[model samples]
Target: MIEYGFRLPSSHDNRPLKFEEFERHLDKTILVSATPGKYDYEKTDKKNIVEQVIRPTGLVDPIVEIQETKGQIDDLIKRLNVVIKNGHRGLITTLTKNSAEKLTEFLVEANFKVKYLHSDIDTLERIDILRDLRLGVIDVIVGINLLREGLDLPEVAFIGILDADKQGFLRSTTALIQTIGRAARNVEGYVVMYADKITDAMAAALSETERRRNIQIAHNLKHGITPQSIVKAVKDIAQHRSTKLKGGKKSDATKVPKEERLRLLAEMEAQMDLASQNFEFEKAAELRDEIERLQAEWGL
Candidate 1:
């Protein structure tokens, strides 16, 4: 079994899973991460440790640059405008949810298509926001913490990390590396950390990124490979899963009256709950997406 995001289960999150539990059940497992923790190293043998430093696509890690925090917002706006003009997206990571929201507002006032994502936003809505970014509905996303891991946005070319010198979990070496990795999918990947002084975390993150980048560059040169931006098909929820309600029955949402649509929505929501309790997550997700689609299409 391939255990991607192996750090989450071992992390000290709100409801962190016991990594030992997976060890107990799975006879053979492969743990994957860019920055594995101490426990992962201790659990595996030296011979078993596999390092995948070079990407198969020959895409090098982003070029990391540090800029002064003075007039950082204005600088970021100028940089984002250039990124958008090149038909690419940008990501900004702030320290807090309020900072993210305020920056998003300022960008909107500057006539940029931007949105903010934080823990306060509903989970489903966050998924929709990310889909919008992928589908080119939005050009920039300002977020905190949530943008660090498990995000695959190949269209993104620039990432601006605000307050990189801040000493905290959010600005730690691991966190900085993960955020910087967001821009790694594109050929023109680049990252800028706005900080007046370089903290230890920032220094380490920059060094490590440069190391990985050198390795990738050497590999590409040896093979005479040209890096290409990752091209992934953006799949909508409705396209991936059928819009038919539970029990495999299809309903034409357009024909339904407003009052009837509301009732149907409620029914589907209840069915979704039941599916959840029954541990039928795939069905529950299908129903949830269908509900969202109907709400958007019908303007419910």
Candidate 2:
């Protein structure tokens, strides 16, 4: 099985699965990450570690800057304004959920298409929020910790890290690097760390970022290449999954009225039954999850 996310199970609080049992079923594994943790490194030899430092787009890593924490939110707004004028997007990471919501509110009042993401948001809503950001429906997304890792927004040119000097897991070296990675896909990617003082974690993260940036720059120079931003196609979720569901069409379930939602859920149930009868277990499982997600979103 291919493990998709960059984060290992140990990094998070919740235990979704027993790692022992997970490994027992594994004959072999290909763990991928920009920064490998101790656990994954221990599982493989040094020779097995493959470095893919060169992005196909030749996009370099972001230039990280430090700013004072005082009035940092306003500074972020100014930076985001510049990014917005350039037809790009920004990601903001605050120290708490309250701050995330407050920043999002302030930005919205400033006439920016903005939203906040946190643990409080439901899964389907989170998906919709991300999709909105990708489609340029929203120009900014504010989050506490979730924006740090596994968030791939190629259009994001600016990343603002509030309270970067705060000594905690959220301000750790690993967290800083991961957050910075969100901007790596864009040609104009840049990170602004709002902190009065540079902590050890900040120092380490900046140094590593600089090291990778130098390597990438040298490769580009040697190859006579110019950097370009990544252009990723945003997939229509329903349409993308429909191919596996046997000619199923797109669902506007998220946008429909309550009555229409119920009708769509009923239709999905019929499709689920057909998938099960066809011995398409995986497709049936996906339909089941989609049905449940719709139910949860609509409070059915």
RMSD of each: 10.2, 11.2
lDDT digits (tens) for residues 1-300 of candidate 1: 126755665355546449776567877768887689887798788899988989989899999999999999999999999999999999999998788889999999999999887666644566677779888899999988755566789999999999999999999998899888989999998999999999999999999999999999999999999999899887666555553533354557668888888898999999987664443445666778788766766777
Candidate 1 off by > 4 Å: 1-31, 44-48, 241-300
Clashes, model 2: 0
**By TM-score, how accurate is candidate 1?**
0.74
All models: lDDT? 0.84, 0.81
User: Distance from true position, residue 136, model 1, in Å?
Assistant: 1.7
Error of 1 at 79 (Å): 0.5
As for model 2, its CA RMSD to the true structure in angstroms is 11.2
**In model 2, what is the error at residue 51, expressed in angstroms?**
2.9
Residue pairs in collision within model 1: none
lDDT of 2: 0.81
* TM-score versus the correct structure, for each prediction: 0.74, 0.71
